[model samples]
Target: MISKTTIDQVYETARLEEVIGDFVQLKKSGSNFKGLSPFSDERTPSFMVSPVKQIWKDFSSGKGGNVVAFLMEHEHFTYPEAIRYLAKKYNIEIEETEQSDEQKEQANERESMYLVSEYARKYFSEILWESEPGKAIGLTYFKERGFTDDTIRKFGLGYGLDQWDAFTQTALDKGYQLEFLEKTGLTIVKEQTTGEPRKFDRFKGRVLFPIHSMSGRVLGFGGRILTNDKKAAKYLNSPESEIYHKSKVLYGIYFAKQAIAKEDNCYLVEGYTDVIQMYQRGVENVVASSGTALTPEQIRLINRLTKNITVLFDGDAAGLRASLRGIDLILEQGMNVKVCTFPEGEDPDSFSKNNSYEDLVLYLDENAKDFIQFKTSLLAQEAANDPIKRADTVRDIVNSISKIPDRIKKEIYIQECAKIMEISEEVLYDTLAQIDKKGFAEASKKIKQEQKAFEVVKNDQVVEKVDVQYELERKIIEMLLLYGNLKQEFEDLVLKENEEGELVLEPEKIEAKVYEKVYLDLQEDEIELTNTQFRTIYYKLIEDLNEREEFTVNTFIANLNQEMVSEVSSILMEEERYVLHDWERKEIYPKEKGQGIAQLVGETILTLRCNLIKTRIQKLQKGTEGNNGDNSEVLEEIVNYLQLNKLLNAKLNRVLS
Candidate 1:
């Protein structure tokens, strides 16, 4: 267990914005920061971060919590893992007591797989640096590729020995489970005809590249065989397991995130060497697809750090054709994409090796082309001779343009296409509109099918009830947030009269405070707001009001979690969007809506408190007038009720006036 002191230090030192900004590109939105949702695909940003409140919320997914919660959700880290990660990021030392064997045995299988993968990574890296075979094979292979010692170590490159069962035997000796080894594809298990277990090393005689998840957990490995064995595959990758999914994983992203964000663009390449070579040459903002076609999931991963992607492809014709589909996928995500090809007979690895860092940077800058223009020009030359092919090429480019989610970007690309193809803009626009209509129709059909399926499992009445409650809660919360601090004067009773004739009633001055009354009334019912955003804001308001200080809207809003701030802001402003016509505007003064909202909120609070006081007064009067109880305590209670009622009435009257 980590010491509580160290956990507190980590939480205190880890700034919410700094921690989250490492994953998402956030731009200032009012007092908070807003960015595209990492959990969902959307063009407009719905993810918010509040530095002041130390929390984040994704409006799209309805997931919002403190910084620790974000890491737990996004990175799939356990509570302790999230804490330890934050500690490492903030440079805090973790003090942990050792776990007993029984406790270790109870750990989950996924965690065990993670432990085994980490152990394997360390073992391979050690072999590469410390053993003779590793030095001669793995070290030499990287050195031959022009990789420096620092680059080799930074990427955790390693070599597996040529001897079969060498890794498996060593792992078994070290108490790591053979089951995990087989499950992670590090060891191969062959079941005999007799149903016996037989184990052997999976990547024997190959150099190993450990693939890591975004949180720095090793999930799988990619191995490259050095020997010329025509029967064997040159490179073998770990199969999909419980943790690693190749389509969603981008190699070097764990290390490239900061540079990508800082530069506001990512340079995408094909292989591990490409990333290493670019990084070593001072172009640090680069990652690889790991020799796979780019996936929407992979593009979304890059989307988290930056909106701009520049794909670096080799000059080989096959390479260019193979990569164009991936560029189309990038365009489909509403991202800014540029394509750059190295000079003929070169790839990113070879080109960077042949030039200085400054020269490489300049070469990429000068050669980068926008996706539309690049695709158009590349295909136009081939289609020049045949009319059918020319029309088909135009349609192909239009299809790629149609994939864009943003209409403005599509329009801009359409105009550019017009200029490049020497065609009228009207024709292109008409074709795009038809394509968009077809796309929307197909989408609507899918939505209808989904809705029908959902309706079969849902109860309409229950949904209606929930909707009603949601609206009511939203209205009440809005009022509390907007006018909870407003104050008014009230009348309080002073002194009861002489024993002689009749009781005298004198008015004493009092201040009508809505916040105190509302807070106290809510407390009496013990009713808590069910909505997370509302509940967070409600508790915070109660805390602030209890401090007996004047409430500052800016200060209160500032202290809320980022998700709640955006939500609260949207709720407060959603209904105020319309501008009045001349006659309607004349009858309605500008400040009426503002004052009316405050008065309605204040009056509702006062009324609720007054009703409660009236009920208490009735009980007191009944106790005093009947012979059921002693009158003195009841009389004191009646006196308090009268005082409270007087205050409430005064506030209501002031508001009415």
Candidate 2:
């Protein structure tokens, strides 16, 4: 367990925007920062970070919390892991108490797998630097490839020993479970006829590359075998597990995300070394697909950082034509993509190694071509001197163009295609329209199928009515969080019998803290928050506010359980979503929170009272209907509740029918 003092230091030192900005590209919007939602595939900026409150909310996915919660959600880190990550990032030394065996065993399966993979990374890295065979084989290979010692260590490059059980035996001896080893694909287990399980290392005799999530947790490993074994594959990757998904993991994202955001463009490459070489050579915003075809999940990872991708390709690779199809996927995500190829005899790995950093940078800049220009020129050469093939080439380019989501961008590309193909804009536009029509028809079919399935489920469910009381209770909590510590003047309504013998509400002005006024009003009415979550949070919030000399939303939220934290954040951030739209600029000003804090508090209390009184009146009327006699007192009570409800509603400016 982490010490309380260390945890407090982390919370105080780590800035929410600075931590989240490493994962998502954040741009300033008013007092907060806005970025694409990392939790969902969103083109619009719905993820918000408030440096003032030290909290973030992703409106698209409805996930919001403090910095710690964001790490737990985004990186799948446990609470301790998140704390430790922050401690590392902010240079805070963690003071810890030793864990008991029971405590160690209590870790979940996913965490166990992560621990095992991380151990494997460390073990292999040690072997590379310390072991004789590792130094001779793996270290030599990397050095020969022109990687410096700092680059190798920075990426956690390692090598598994040639012996089959070297890693498996060591992990077992260290008390790590064989179950986790097998799950993480570090040790392959086989059962023998004699009932003993056979276990061996998965990446034996191979140099290892650790694949990390955006937050630098070791998700899995990609291994390349050094020996000339014709029977074995040259490269192997860790099998998918609960913690690691290859399609969603990029090779160097942990290292490249900051640079990618800073540069506003990502360099996409084909393999691990291509990324390392380019990133090592001062081109920092580079990542690789790790020899896999591009996936939407992978693209979405990059989409969080930037909207532009530049794909680097080897000149002599035979799959150049096949790779062009992947560029369309990038375009479909509404991202700008450019293609750059090295000179005839080289790939990114060899080219970066051979050339100086300045030359490599210059070469990329000079050769990079827009997808439209590159595809048209490459295909046009093949279709030259044949009108039939020429027409097919034009259609192919237009098909790629049809994938763009933006209407203006689509029109612009169409015009550009017309110029490049020496064809009329009308013809290309007609092709784009035909493609879109077919696509829309297919999409409509899928939606109808999905709707039918949804209707079946929907029919079996009960539709819940809106809970007005819950909303009122939630509003009170919001007000408490927003203005609990501020002193304000309030209009307290006193219900008294006027001279005409009718109960009437008289406004009395009073000065008090907002929380004090709210507390007094609710206490006088004997109104309790009926919702269990609100009821639990209300007393705790009130206690914290009264005892502390100051109130901070982030600190208060940090002390609550996740469910209550979510509720408080949902209440507080409900108004933040609308901040994106500047209504004042359009001559439509919305009520500011600070300007109406006192009225808002008074109105929320009034609405809750009205709702409660209305409920009481209904119960009385129901009781009168059931009973045949002695209903006069209940009738009088209902009438009194009705009068009180009317007055409360009047104060709230709500018409009662």
Candidate 3:
């Protein structure tokens, strides 16, 4: 465990822009840096990083948080890993309080897997650099691939020994459990005829490539065989595990993310070496599909950085007819895809090796073909003088175009396709509209089917409906975070029962801090938030404010667990999202909470109380149905609740009751 002092030092030293800038190209926009969202596809810059507030928000994805929170979301890193990453980046020394045996035993499943995977990455990197067999095989293979020593180290390339149990033995000796080793697919466990099971290295004898999450934590490894044994598979990847899901990960996203964001273009390739060689040659914005058929999740990963993807293929690798079979997914994601083919008899690795960096880059720029033209040219060659095949090829091209989400892009592609295939533009548009209508109908049908599948079952007794005040509850915490320490004087609008037993609002001057008033109001009414997470935050806020003379968002967040931090961030940023749009710029006076801090806090609590009374009145009404006794008392109670609800709503300036 890292010491609290060390974590705090790292947090204070790590600038939000400086940290996020490594993975995103940020241009100064007023007081903040704006870039294309690292979490979604877009042409305009919607991702904002504010050094003043020490937070970032991706308007597209609706994810906003502080530095550590960004890392956790972006990299799928555990809390400790995120802290350590920041500590390393900012050059802060980390001090640890070592965990005991009991603490180790109590560690969660995800943390254990991360620990084992990180250990394996270090172990493999060590073997590649130090061990003789590793040098003769893994290091030699990497060098021969034209990767420099620094590049290999930067990417964390490594070697897994040929020995059957070398890694397995080292891990167990280091106090790592055999179960985790097996779960990470680092150790292959085999059952014997009699006695304990035998274990061996899964990546034994293969050169290793550690696949990283966007924030640069090792999630899994991909190993390539040095020997082309006919009976064995050429490449063996880590099997599915809790820590790594291949579909959600790109091979070199962590390395290429910033480049992709800066260049506003992503180069898609088929293998790890393709990305490595291109990156080595200065085309840093490239990632591989890792030989798996590209899943929607994979396309979406690339989609986050840029909408433009230039897929590079060696001459023979272009089974253009077959390649187009998978490209519909990219179009569906609204990516502007272009195809670039290398010289005949050459892959990206060999081509880059054979040509100078200048020539290689110039050739890619000149040869890149928009998808419509690329598909038309390739299929036209195969369709040579055959009208039927030509018609079918045009349909295929139009089909891909129809999947495009941008209407303007679709229209442009329609024009290009019509020009290339000599088909009428009207016909293409008609076909596109038909496809879109059918798609909408199918989607609607699916939603209906899903809705039908959702059924609620209850006991014979009445089901007590939970009438929640989430918005008001959220407002209460928001005010606590924003203005809890600020003092305010206001006319007390507390409703009271006079001697005649009539409810009336008695306005009187009362002065108190926001937190004090909120605490007293809730305590007086004995009201608590019904939502579990909000309730927890509410209590923590009161305790902290009570102990200190001041309240700040940073102070409030520091005490929360990761889950609670995310919850608070969501509530705080939900309003910030609107503010970020500059509604005030449009001749609109956006309601500033600071203007009516006292009123906001009181109204929030009053609204919650009013809602609770409404719920009770509803229950009483349910009770009254079939009740033959004491109708006058129930009527009076309902009227009183209604009057309270009306008074609360009036205080909020709400016109609707």
TM-score (all chains, Cα) for each model:
0.78, 0.97, 0.83
Candidate with better TM-score, 2 vs 3: 2
Tens digits of lDDT, candidate 2, 264-321: 9999998999999988899999999999999999999999999999999899857888
What candidate 2 gets wrong by more than 4 Å, as runs, is: 452-464, 581-587
Better of 1 and 3 by TM-score: 3
Cα deviation at 595, candidate 2, in Å, is 1.8
Arrange candidates, best TM-score first.
2, 3, 1
Q: After superposition, how far is residue 15 of candidate 2 from its true place, in Å?
A: 0.6
Q: Which 10-residue span in candidate 2 carries the lowest summed lDDT? A: 452-461
lDDT of each: 0.79, 0.90, 0.83
- lDDT of candidate 3 at residue 415, scale 0 to 100: 97
Q: Give candidate 1 misplaced runs (Cα > 4 Å).
A: 100-102, 448-657
Residue 70's lDDT in candidate 3: 84
